[model samples]
Target: DQQVKQNSPSLSVQEGRISILNCDYTNSMFDYFLWYKKYPAEGPTFLISISSIKDKNEDGRFTVFLNKSAKHLSLHIVPSQPGDSAVYFCAASDLSTSGTYKYIFGTGTRLKVLA
Candidate 1:
């Protein structure tokens, strides 16, 4: 049912380095955004997120920024660790589409942190 069915590209980073994940959406209507990290056999855990009205949001080692004019958003993970390895997902929803929240997810990108 998901639009993104292919295995996403992988990124490798050295431990203690910065890992940057990028997401670009086609729809300009997308208003809310979220970033999630999923480990094998486990549900995704929320990392960070931002709204269309806000340009940036940060939480601890994670930061997410939205560019409404460009229809793009990115996540930055600083001081990456081996335990940070996971599949990262970008999700977005538009309030105009429905009063309730219905998220459209991007094909996950796999991140591997090497020690």
Candidate 2:
């Protein structure tokens, strides 16, 4: 079973506009949720993260929101740019007291920013 899922396979937006990507998870053990941006031929890089203790986290043009009760999370990018065109992935880490931490990732959502 997929613990994390990105319902949309892809998203397109005009440059300088807002882009929103949604994700959902089924694991309640997930305490840390993260977003990653990956370009072709490159590894995914960390974007932003939100802890289950917090509802939201923002950095510059990127923001992440987590709804624990709904088991959902979303990433918002303001003023999207062409450079932002890439695959976005939602990841969650389960921090267990027994040291059974594991990271689960969504399939990924390809975002294309048109000029």
- Kindly report which residue stretches of model 2 are placed more than 4 angstroms away from their true locations once superposed: 98-100
Reference-based lDDT, each prediction: 0.85, 0.94
Question: Which residue pairs does candidate 2 place in steric collision?
Answer: none
Best-matching candidate per lDDT: 2
Clashes of 2: 0
User: Largest TM-score belongs to which candidate?
Assistant: 2
Using all chains and alpha carbons, the TM-scores for the candidates as numbered come to: 0.90, 0.95
Candidate 1 lDDT over residue span 1-115, tens digit each: 5432224478999999999888888777788899989999999988887988899999999999888887778889998999999999999889767688888888999999999
- Write down the worst ten-residue block by lDDT for model 1: 1-10
Model 1, total clashes: 0
